[model samples]
Target: MYSWQNNEYEADGVTPKLSEAKRGPADPRLTQSNEDQLNVLLGAVVNYDKVIGDHTFNILAGVNRETIRNDNFSAFRRFFISNDIDYMFAGGDAEKDNGGAAWERARLNYFGRANYNYKGKYIAELLWRVDGSYMFPKDTRYGFFPGAMLGWVVSEEDFWKDNVPFVNYFKIRASYGQMGNDNVYYNDELQEYQYFSTYGFGTYIINDAMVKSLMESRVPNKFITWEVANNYNLGFDFQFMDGKFNAEIDLFKNSRESILWQRNASIPQSTGMSLPAENIGKVDNSGFDVSLGYRETFGELGFNVAINGGYAKNKIIFWDEAPGAPEWQKSTGRAINAGLYYNYAGVFRDQAEIDANTIDYSDITGNLRPGDMKYEDYDGDGKITPNDRVRRDMNNVPTFQGGINFGFNYKNFDLAILFQGATGAEQRVGTDESGAIGNFLLDFYENRWTLDNPSSEYPRITDRSDQYYSNNNTYWLRSSNYLRLKNVELGYNFSTTWLEKTGISSARIFLSGQNLLTWSKNKVLDPESSNALGHYYPQARIINSGIMVSF
Candidate 1:
């Protein structure tokens, strides 16, 4: 397969300036941008199957190649004579600029698989693959991976079928596999050709004259290669009550190594040079998934319900740790990208309570008083300093997630509904700079600490400059667990006899809704949003109706 894409855009800044704009009087500018992209995919597959008596054989093989290229250019000019002539040629060239960029990459892979079964009761399989990546050096570009699986169907045996009359089918399986990852990203940006030293375009003042020049941007690493993961899985599938009930359960564990990262914590900033990235990190993750379903029919009415859930957690087995670093501040043995914050103790209820305390908080705030937030001396030190910060194993990614789907049909009418939820995650929801910008939330303001209320959950009203409000602490962290009504639909199908006279094979009308309702502890913002700081938009709720027909 091959594809190409082209995009062209032209705009006039003066046309919309009849009303006031952000920067005051409009400069009457014209801009144009052109982008082109091409993608190609080449692959082939071969399959063979044979059966003799109680034995069966299946074989497969395939090879694939992919390539991509992109190019873009943009230009803008100011001081246009009029809006009527909104072309680049009509604008002055003194204040004009233009830029362009181009990039290309390719990859190739070869894989194959084989399977064998005995009387459809026992099964075994084996597979292997090799991958070549464009981002790594030629000598270290290819990686080999292999996997195998075995299964048993106890219900298919004659003795088990006679002993267990109610149960219809049962199967158990186990598998192990190794895989390689070539796509790597840093700071949310894709890192390409990381093994090569690169340069960037820049401007510098040489002898009082501005001149364009190329500057070194990154250091080279000839050993950088693919990250690898070894995965193991054991699962079972069963159906009982004459196929009315079914369930599937799986347990999995994975170990990932050679993660690409720069040892910023171990490297000193005094070196004054950008260091290359290395593959020296390892992590382990374990999880379980369960799915249950039931179906029944009462005369013309029928319905089905299913529930699926999964729970996963991970720990960093190895990472770059600064020498002599405190145990509480180390990233090893903790979740990936864990955050550090002051452990919140409570709010100072009164001045007498503050004066009687022995922990010295002068390092954090000079004027400690009532209604202020308090912190714990995590290091057993006498003062509340930077050493007191502790790590919290929580982030925006949920550890437990599940969903429920229900549908039913009665005669010519049908309905469906879906519910979803998540837990074991947290987000910092409160405002960072209060008073100057605004208070964190309306609920926080109503329950704020004061002389009369003396609430323990919230601190007193304070400005942005207050030391108590500026600290990164657990007081701002909130559980992001939430359950939501994801989707619902109702439809009516036309009867076959009625559609026959209309020359139509079938027809139906339906009404649907999405993001209808949500239940969460954090009411100020959507719990699923990573940007709890209010920089992101909340999910939209929609309701619509439509019709479908086939003739």
Candidate 2:
């Protein structure tokens, strides 16, 4: 259970009439909210294992159900003689807008799986599940998903032992499955308006009398159902040198279809009516992940090291749109974070060069002058119009990310460290996006072009030319590659013989540090997070020393 309360004062200075949007202490407002939820669950499981000849069978079945609910409310008041008395009962005016909401949800599922193997060389497994959610109408509330996997252990075969003594084991497996997402919103849970029509009161004046009229605020679609994801994965595992070295790798692909997106934004305005949500979008995401490790002993010291990395890329394959946009205006078939902007050539230094340039100044900046951004005539038409700009999609985010970790041990002492980073990423910079003026980095003005400097890299600092510094372009894109010392730790274990009289069973001391160092060309923010607006707090450096003991 949790409870919340809010109290605030708003000075009246800028509004013609005071209301909920611009409330004053005459509103002597006090708001409170209390919320609690209870979930009850029941489940049953049965398992069976049998061995017949050279084959083994393992099976399992289960059924589960759960229920949950939440409720909340808040109220406001106005025209209080004393600000100390803030409750609704102590006020002279009733709040025009005070309400609350409550929602209940339940889910049920039945699932089963079976596995079988022959001589521990060949393996196969199958699974099936039936799930139901109250988010949908009763007529089409249930969904069925199934999955299967198969594997082969090549090292189990005798032929490998005689042919490759150094190789210990090798196995390969693949799986395919489908899943359902009951969450209707891409970022929020299902809401009452998503399931049915929603209504609100509209104020109107008729015959010199004020009246309240009921109006539909949201359209409804009863046929909406599930957004589904179909996935496939293939993986392999192997070991060498009697388990001294080992590695496992997997590749996966998934397609999420029938995604829920409110189509009202794309509907044609001529229709004169607003629309609702529908299953009209799709996305395809695929990536691979792998890991490797090694362990060895030298004299009394031991070495265990591992390095692993992976990458993922996604694109919007399908979406709903109006028919009249330019072909380049549509960003489908590109990475979701892709962008388009004008192309930057260089900065103009003197008026003579600006007058001699082939670009038609009137086409872009009617009052063109020196020290403004020089834009390329990508279309080669001698006119730098909107059509001259091009579309691009890359370097928005790193498609590859990975890390290297290793550790060493000698008797009672041990040490470990990790180096991690990402590549193939890019970001845009400038006061317009990340921030501006007082928020500029210390080095922002260091190399900027000036009358005495006339540098080609940066334009003169001026607010007059929006076309130069305010526009986005390739010039703003910066590489986001970085190498960071992620974590390091050193520890030593106390020997039992040295602590014979201490009465403690075990004890150890350790020191650890995180985000100790970073190397990169990115100056705006942490490269990994792409913090442009300075909204993100830079990663913190953490160090600690602790002792552990058990009795």
Error of 2 at 225 (Å): 2.4
Clash pairs, model 2 backbone: 395-426, 434-532
lDDT of 1 at 191: 81
| lDDT (Cα, 0-100) at 352 in candidate 2 | 83
TM per candidate comes to: 0.83, 0.84
| Root-mean-square deviation per candidate | 7.8, 6.8
lDDT of each residue in 357-395, candidate 1, tens digit only: 899988878888788888999999788998898888866
TM-score, candidate 2, is 0.84
Q: How accurate locally, in lDDT, is each candidate? A: 0.86, 0.78
- Candidate 2 local lDDT, 158-189, one digit each (tens): 89877987889999999999888777764365
lDDT of 1: 0.86
